[model samples]
Target chain A: MGTWLALVASLNGLAAGAFLLGAFGLLATRQMLGCVRFFRLQSLALVASIFLIAIGMRVPDLIAVALLDLAIKPLLIPWLLRRYVREELFRRREIDQLLNIPTSLVIGLTLTLTAYFLAGVLPPAAGAMGNINVPIGLAGLLLGAYTLAVRREAVPQLIGIFAIENGSLFAGIAIAPRLPLVAEMAFPFDMLIIALVIGILTRITHERVGTTRVGALATLREGAPK
Target chain B: MTLFVILALPLIAAIVSALPLGRKLAPSATLLAAVASVCLVGRAALTVAAGHRVVAVPDWVELDGLGALILLLVAVVGTTAALFSWGYIAREENSRHLRQYYANYNLFVFSMLAVPMLVEPALVWTAVELTTIFAIYLVAFDNTPEAVEAAWKYSILTIMGGAMALLGFIVLFHAMRFGNEPFTWAGLVKLAPKVSPEVLESAFLLILIGFGAKVGLVPLHTWLPDAHSQAPSPICALLSGVKTTVVLYVILRFVPILNASGRINVDRWAIIVGLISVGIAAFLILQVTDYKRLFAFSTVEHMGIILVAAGLGGAAAHYGAVYQILNHSLTKSFCFFAAGTTLLAVDTRQIADLRGLIRTSPIAGVALLFGGIAIAGAPPLAVFLSEFSIFRSGIAGQHYIAIGLLAIFIIVAFFGILHHLNSMVFGEPMPQATPMTPVHLPLSSVLTLILAGAPIVILGLYMPSFLHRILQTAAQGLAG
Candidate 1:
């Protein structure tokens, strides 16, 4: 490979690793702000990978997607959430998760490894430009799903979903860099709506239910549980 | 021209209804748009059913035999739900929340209509996700703690599923990118044979499991009963009736593509998931204490049957699948409307709480019982005809094991439904604790029921030859 191409590829590998690390950071974070911070950082890593892939592969549309990710994920979504959801919800509050940090990390690792195995099922032709991004991005995606499963707080669960979105786009840019820019542009707009809608929902849940501990929502269960 | 018109009507209604309008204005605007769209969709369906694909922009904006079927059902329900909402929401909710409800309702209908009209796969995914977002507000419109909680669970889980499905779509684009094909469903089927099976397999599984959560497939269906039951009854009609079918239609688009790819046992995947959903939801139906929840679980059961028929993989089976699609959407919506009326009369959702419904309000009691029987696949009903066709195809194909299990599950669900309906509709009058006083049923609500109920009864006895032709075309396209 040419030197410039090699450098981009290697830097993308670092971004992919940091991307997965951000997922792990989500699992490790205790505060709601910490979870959001990890999600922003994960999205940044995704943007980095997208940017590198855009320049290296000369796929012009991904550059736009990278900018959209940079603007939306790291900045706009959080700001929108803050504006809509009360400040108290984002206060340095610890989140109540289903599992402890250590156990969650172990499961996170297992999920990441499994994601690699899933990617390993593909022919080498599968990840033509994906290189390390495919497996690492899959790991990030799996870890994000894990984060969603374990997080009980509404905002943290929301962050977990964003993590999944970031992780998937992280893999997507490398795999389908040439997708139409219009389609790629729709992603940011879609995220804006998601943040707005979920932000409103979280606010409503907090106001009406007196808590955002949504996992305990058990009224509709069969047998009309006590 | 007509496609854009159909899409534009709901969007215009959404904006207009969201404005600070009088209470009647929002529902009126929404109902007008819905009824107008139904007329337009009827024309489109007829054209497509008569043998021409509807294409607005070749590969980008289009509809086909299968798309026409879905679009037609969504339009029909949108009209009835709009009418039903006119009475249900005005009577139950604060007048201040009325415009907001109608706005969200129109937007929800718009998103669903967009799903079948957009031929681009990624655009289709966006439309599907849009349905979830737009409907979240309506799901939580009750403003009760339980309602918000249901909306929260529904949105979070389904949005997660949508995210996962996003990855699936992205991977699918990568698979198709090199083939120089247009990324439409038709284009993908053509490209599938050349793509590596591993890539296609991963894409198929991702999309299936991702969309499956939204479709109320087993293991990801904890939210369906809660969300469907808690949403105001009109929204529940949309939720249980056509919403699940919309997402399932997206998943079914892949079955043929995977089959075209060759080497993947996609049928087994559908069958396994279908059977599990049917088996689990059948028992859940028996245990459900709430009448609305009983209908919700029945939705899951019917979805399983459709998926199984689609998986059975023959022209006849595919025909059964599409036929069930039509029957389920119409009858299930009617069931929810019935449940809504029953709620109107007795002011309780609990099956145990209702007694001597026929004496209290004959219209509601009769509608409830008829809806239950129809959805339970009683003979001479639309669901019964379609289900029997599925069994016929399965037996003809000699799939004895799957056919046997499906038959047993159907019977269990049928008895469970009848048991619940029987107790609620026809018991001795209770001591006058609350005196079983029936509220005055709304003219709009009664009229909505009548309008929606005709097809359930009529289609059972006889289907128009044109609809049969459309179903045949839809089946052929779905089964490849």
Candidate 2:
């Protein structure tokens, strides 16, 4: 029993660490490909966390959810994104982020602190699960918001969004174990649809402007085009 | 019987419209389905007026006084739009695109109908999200790059807002788990007293911002003008008028819970956000150049006004909000329909390019003029009645500053609308070197104009006893 508990704890710790690392790397990394790769790693860590939780809780439905996450997040989404990147032949080494890396990193650290502070504020409802997982989820939320605020490239912004979803899923598993399985299943389907739509939009963007950068397409404005 | 008809009729019509045979029958079929849905909604409204809650699918779908009021607005406008589409699409000339247009239109109506019927919070979230996805196709139907980009931005912003709402739902589910019963309105109400105040407060805030984005409150309202300006005129009517109201209904669903929990103060926050949105959108309305975009910003302004009334939380204020919703749905959709006719005649959405509408098409010109007056809250229009009630309630509630600012913004916006109406409806017709192909107005368009215009005229002069009772019940529901 001790061994199993230790294993589960260790895996969760590793997953949480990987999530934080990926979030920081997403902010720190200048290259678009590097951010994508970091997101893939973050998704892998998410899969591992869910798998560990399912084994610890002896919940079979969660295992199915874990499998779905593995199949879609780590495999299908990355593959689709790879095709988009290659076809577009993006050569830009660094995206002109809204905020510099240093500033984003500082903001990320503050967000992590806020998450930790918030976790302390949550009253114990789902045992130690809430205590441990809520902060991680908060971190994920902040990271997603930060990515959305800073990133110029459409693809990286999408990754940031998925990362936020990953965090919310983690929080859901910890806080609401009895959440209807149907709702859990709906999450991946929604994500898949969002990914497909984003992919199509990216393709269209590439076709229209010869680049996937969103900032260039500001010609259609209110009153008149700038 | 009524609930099932309301849900299934439009869905079946949408499916049939996608078929080859249904192409020739598309307009009439949609009109028939819409009329059927409206009749059912009217029956539901009557039932609610008689002091009975209509539980459609029991735990999964139900209609209360509030839902019934929104349903009536949706049904009335939907029927009108359907009638208008019949004549409007025939003028398209391009057969394939016309078919696609009707198909999307039917699906859009189906989604809007589903929103009020959905009872479960999670189901409501999904329904609202479906409305966004369905409307995206409509917004981008023109296939113009600008239209497509607007659709994409709209989809992304709304979906992201939906994600936040999903998180809010998760929190709500967690809070509700303290109760013994399943997830339903009754269950939530029963559990409200026992649930943690902190959880309820946080969940309410999340839902507010999440769905508030969809309601096109300022800051998050960036997509409203873009999507409204880009989508076809009929769709603009639905998007700005019915669809936003449906999402606002979802947000309003949480009010009773928040009030019951006694931990969160909903009215104060709603007032702050409402005033800010109304004030910002009113100014932005003044600066806008595109006529469609002007109406689009006006939507944001009106939504802000309704929210402000709702936030005031008195019997009169709540009733005013409900009345404003119905009036805005009628007036805004009428304006859009007129805008569509004018666009078809003049071939431009730019306020400067659209002049001499009266000389070109007097029917459209009169429609635009009257529609503009109605939206601007002219006397003898339902909007004027509702806005007056709201102002009276605001002052009664000791919100003197809010009332003063609201009046100022409304006056400014009225002038802005007048500037465009003057240019578009009264100027001499711009001469075309080549004789232009005359586009005929649809019977549906005429029906839409009448249906949209009727409520404004009738409700302004006198409020029916049944509708007055229904609004009172709905107001009480919000107040609780």
Candidate 3:
């Protein structure tokens, strides 16, 4: 490979690794603020990867996607979360994770490795411009799903969901950067609505119940212990 | 032109209904748009039934026999739900919240309508996701503690599912060579043979699990009961009847492509999941105390039956599946409408709290009783006929184990539903119940109930041959 191509590949690899690290950071962090920071970093890595791919593949639409990615994820979503954190309305400050940090990290690693194996099974997109990012993208997605499942607090769960969106976009940019303009633009707008609705719910929930922990949501179920 | 009107009318209604001057007029305005939707969708259905596909913009917007069938569903259910909402929400008399309610309600209808109209796969996914967002606020419309909680759980879980769906679509997009050719449903089916087996396998599994959660298949169905039970009754009908069908439509779109790939036993997986959902939800039905929740679990059960039919994967089974989709959509909506009416009169959704419903409100009690019978798959109802066809197809395909399991679950569900309805409709009035005095319903609510109810019986006894022929074409389209 030429020097420029090699450099681009290395840059993508670094950003992808950063994405994984951000996921791990989410599992390790106890504070709500820490979870949001990790999500922001993860989204930043995704935006960086999208930017690199846009320039490398010369896809102008992807460049637009990257710009929206920056605005929605790294900037707007964190701003929303930070506003929640500042209010300190939710009683639960710690993540109160369902799984321990170390076990969660190990599971994250296992998921990443499994994603790599899964990607290897598929025939390589022949002559694809980008190289070897699909595995990392899948890894990020699995880990995000794990976070969403394991976290007890609403904010951390929101972060987990954000991470999943980031992973999806990262994977999309790496592997299939040629979606129609409408489909490409829809994800970020969808993100904006998700963030907005979640923000409102979190506030409403905290105000009513004094905590945004979903464990307390059991009252709606068919049979609850008296 | 018809397609554009079908897609645009709900959206225009949504915006106009939200404006200050239109808040009082929201119900009428939305009702008009919904009526227009029915006419346009029926026209499109007729055109497709005549053996020519409706292709308005090639890959961007098109309708075939399958789309036409689903479009017909959105139109009928959307109109009925709006009609019911007029009576349901008006009595609440919270004018301040009515604007937001109608706005989101119309938007939800629009999203469901767009699902069948759009031909682009990614755009289809986007429309499905939009339904969740639009309806989340509606689910939490009452802003009660339980309402918010249900909305929160529903949104988070479904968005996670949406993420996986997005990944699945991205992989499919990549597999299709990044839209080098048309990536529409027809395009993908044509190209499916060339796509690698492993890629197809992975993509199909991901898509199934993702959309399965949205369909309220078991194990991922924790939110379904809660969301449906808590949402306003009219919206509950829409969610149970129309929204789940719309998402399932996305999954069915992939059947032709998966078959073409020739790598995966996609139907077997569908059948397995379908059976599990049917089996689990059947028992869960017996445990639910809320009348709305009882209806909600039934929704899950019927979805399982549809999946099982689709999984049987024969010409007969495919027809049964599509027919079941129509039957379940109409039947479930009518059931929800019944549950809503009862809840309105008795001022409670708890089954134990309701008694002598027929004594208190004959319209609601009769609606609940017959709607329950229809949904429980009794003879001479649409559900029973469709389900019988599914069994015939299963036996024809020699899917003995699946058929046996299905029969057991359907019987269990039958008792579960009737047992609850029997008590609620026939018992002596609960003395402690606040609304011991009989309550009268608005003429509009009664009319909408009849509008939804008559179809359950009429379609069961005799289907128009034209509609039957269209359903056959739709099933064939799915079977490829």
DockQ of each: 0.76, 0.40, 0.69
- Model 1: lDDT of residue B181: 86
Residue by residue across B1-480, what tens digits does model 1's lDDT show?
899999999999989998885777888999999999999999898898888878899999998888999999999999999999888888745665888888899999999999988989889988999999999999998899989988998998899999998888888887775487898999988998898887788887888888999999999999999899999999999999999999999999988999999978899998889999999999999999999999999999999999999999888999999999999999999999999998888788888878878887889999999999999999999999999999999999998999999999999999999999899888875655144444788998899899989999899889999888878778877976
Q: Which regions of candidate 3 deviate over 4 angstroms?
A: A82-86, A89-92, A122-129, B178-180, B434-436
Q: Tell me how far the alpha carbon of residue B4 in candidate 3 is from the true structure, in angstroms, after superposition.
A: 1.4
How do the predictions measure up, each by TM-score? 0.98, 0.92, 0.97
* Docking category of candidate 2: acceptable
Clashing pairs in 3: none
Error of 3 at B97 (Å): 0.3
Off by over 4 Å in 2: A28-36, A55-61, A76-86, A89-94, A119-125, A208-211, B1-5, B90-96, B430-439
Interface RMS deviation of candidate 3: 1.6
What DockQ would candidate 3 receive versus the native complex? Answer: 0.69
Q: What overall lDDT goes with each candidate model?
A: 0.88, 0.78, 0.85
Q: Kindly report which residue stretches of model 1 are placed more than 4 angstroms away from their true locations once superposed.
A: A122-129, B432-438
lDDT of 3 by residue, B90-135 (tens): 8766676898888889999999988988989888889999998899
Task: Please report the candidate that would top lDDT against the real structure.
Answer: 1
lDDT of 1 by residue, A116-217 (tens): 887776333233445788778788888889889988888888988888888777777767777777788887789899999999898889899998887777
**Which candidate, 1 or 3, has the higher TM-score?**
1
Q: Write the per-residue lDDT of candidate 3 for residues A10-128, one digit (tens) a residue.
A: 78778888988898898788877778788888889988888878777778888888888899888987787666543563333674678888998888889989988877754453325
Which candidate's TM-score is highest? 1
